[model samples]
Target: MNLLNQTNEKIIPSLFLLLLITGLFSCTSESELTQVDVVVYGGTSSAVIAAVELAQSGKSVVIVSPDIHIGGLSSNGLGFSDTGNKEAIGGLAREFYHRVWQHYNDSLAWNWEQHSDFGNRGQGTVAMDGESRTMWIFEPHVAEQVFEDLIAENKIPVFRDEWLDRETGVEKENGRIVAIETLSGKRYRAKVFIDATYEGDLMAAAGVSYHVGREACDEYGEKWNGVQAGVFHHTHHFQVPIDPYVIPGDPSSGLLPKIADEKPGANCSGDDKIQAYCFRLCMSNHPENRVPFTKPDNYDPNDFELLGRLFDSGWNEWFNKFDLIPNRKTDTNNHGPFSSDNIGMNYDYPEASYERRQEIIQEHANYQKGLLYYVANDERVPEKIREEMKNWGLAKDEFTDNGNWPHQLYIREARRMIGEYVTTEKDILGERLVPEPIGMGSYTMDSHNVQRFVTEEGYVQNEGDLGVHPHAPYQIAYGSIIPKKEECKNLLVPVCVSSSHIAYGSIRMEPVFMILGQSAAVAATIAIDDKSAVQDISYLEMREHLMQKKQVLSLND
Candidate 1:
């Protein structure tokens, strides 16, 4: 169970030997070295889009990814895209959707269900738009294939399953990153680097300043920034008075599982707590394609005791978020109280070591699996609910390598880089015009429940669920993607941009990530041509390039 110790004892030694050998043979062997114009460090949607942009621009780029699979949450199970203003999404992001549209137009893509039978329902828009030639929703496998096709067509080299050596991996000279070495001892030399990871691991390892948790409203001069103790924008909170104790009315008994044994923090104050994380499951209702929810190893029924209590409290809205995708499958997300989001369990994940992070990931996987099994099989679950739950299982075709479970965890929020410009709620609300626009974000500012804590009334309640819509689609500034010149001159972070916690809630959409990724690549090219730092790149020139690439930088465009 001590994953860190095991990694240190076994993996570290072998990695060290590999590093030593690679260092000794550094001058002679070309296999250990790769030189590219840009090294995008991640396999997320943004990483793929950035690499493709660089390739299309005739620049050599490579993706050094920690994931075995490509496309992050987009290919995982987030097929129910959270697109705000679809028109605001253009460039490579829209191209990705257009490719998805092209795929579904073929009859072979609709194997489980007929294309005509599948209704055109999406998140506040049509699933498929014939006029725009874009499909906003799709299956996990289809999204993955689209990313793979883009990589293949662009001829971008990708090194899969290569983890960054966070401690001594990056070599910087005169505030510029010279090269970066992975744990496998392969060194990549690049003029510009893009960190497209959800966790911002490379950005953190490169000594860039970042924030892990929510900031106080005062810090950013904004509402909905910090620990929202009383705000409940979503229905994920306890509606009725639920006892916190294990035994119904006994004061001697301890608190129920998953309920924090502390007071909900002061409202509008800063806290080092992160929003919950969960796996956006891709499930199927089709009998032929369904893989019944199986009982996971070490399954304990007591873990879901609170959920059973909730069921007893007359809450039967568990099926509210089974958003349907193509091929009779669903992009299942965390919905009701005591659902998939493991509240207050991922606070350390943003800064944890790789081994420690794996432990956390495994723990979350077990918790979710146990919850599913409990709801589907346990006698404590209502008979009506159990019968319906039994019909839906994991899709057999999706994530074939990982037992039909999602390969990527829904990392809702993580280490956000405090780069040259920090995007606050003001920027998202259009109170202040963003300077040097690169991309636009129009999604509602949303955050899942952060903690399940006991109220003063001695009842269990969830906190930190927030949803606020912007006045209009807001432009993202170029400064948000680049690090401060003194921190790192040649690095860009598109996924984990420089933003406040609340502002990030709006910016952290897949399409926006792709748009920013393409814009980052354009900025990288500008920096390279001008022989200047990423901070010093000419915004006017970069804007010209972005427009030519068909990136939607403004509402007027």
Candidate 2:
């Protein structure tokens, strides 16, 4: 009777042993199985919003999150919001900001500084609006708390740290995903699945089509699609000529660290290179809340030789992008020719194995951490810059679980699903009309530097940094979120949407992801109710529901 305690029993019957093994296997499988109306994968801002929307719509939904902490980059130091057209953001996305505004309204929220001391600085509008009751900029912890509150208020069940079995987790029948199993053996069965991950892992595992890296200009009929070798946008590129070799003008000395040896590809041509990734560090100048930057274990002064040379050349713009957030904190992003963007080091991240991706992430973290340490302590740095850098450090109260470092990397670009409709610059620039509008995006087509390589003239330069403003806030089509019917009928992709690299540059904003997440949930709900494919959902009906939910589908709306 005590089968679990049996070890080399005197005369165990084979028949009894077989029955016991079968029963145990069945019980294990049953316990691991989770059935729901909709399963949202990922733990990003989009994932949280999608699950909340599904719950609000009376669907039995569950969030199978790969992240231990939700809200992705929003809570991971990107609190200086990149919202372009504030009016274009509505639905749960706007609600998230409203909650942020509410939290800051309390005097207790300002722990480090007075509310009036925090100036109203934002991308294009006031950071905090009294009439709209929305606050665009915030501290990282506050954003994370808002996301947690939303999930708790909606009673959404989130299984955190559940990594999907990317190779064979998705169980498909007749091109529809029946279930997805995580690496922990937890199985999620749902009528509809939404891939809210920035990496598009679920969509790819479900055999959905996707494209990585940049597309050629001709492929999508877009002007800013491919290798932008000579195009310099913003202030990320070198303003003056910087030598590529360790010895100035001596090619025999070899290229300096961080400078790619390969020649940058031709302009207007396609390449497999992706934009650089960095940690949007939440830094603080307040002495009580600042954790002074420390040199990384693997810090190599030689790695920053170019940066030292740039300093010698009078390129002192390190603090230009330390955008201010509340609580006397800053959302410090990459700036100048050599700041934090780890260029040419993440090309294999989008499709790499999980272990490999982690390695890449760690490598990036080390590079950034080392850069900060070098600036603060290295004698090569200018005294003015070094003294100023010493004042800022990682926020002591943020990302407590990760040694005050940001938990999420700014995955600027990744595997983009090539769904029914691929958004291109034509759509973003108002040259082409979007069909079946679901949301609107107005951010500039902004792509960070992809590669830092030696020019034909033998000088160091950065390529693929672009910033072209859209004609206006443009509508995003429903087809952009759903896979082709033949590929996967029951799955929707909100984060890694179908779009050309240039168009995704604008649509990739955090607020846009939240907007699409809500829209995707609504579409999935319609598909589940009608017992129809996500691709076949009626656009008119979806539009009506979106309007009711206060989603800004177009500029006219």
RMSD per model, one decimal: 4.5, 6.8
Candidate 1 whole-model C-alpha lDDT, 0 to 1: 0.90
Task: For residues 434-490, write the lDDT of model 2, one tens digit per residue.
Answer: 899999999999999999988877789999999999878999999999898899999
- Judged by whole-model lDDT over C-alpha atoms, candidate 2 comes out at 0.90
Instruction: Write candidate 1's Cα lDDT for 276-308 as tens digits.
Output: 999999999999999999898889998899999
TM-score of each: 0.95, 0.95
Model 1 CA deviation exceeding 4 Å by range: 1-31
Q: All candidates' lDDT scores?
A: 0.90, 0.90
Candidate 2, residue 183: lDDT = 79
Q: What TM-score quantifies how close candidate 2 is to the native fold?
A: 0.95
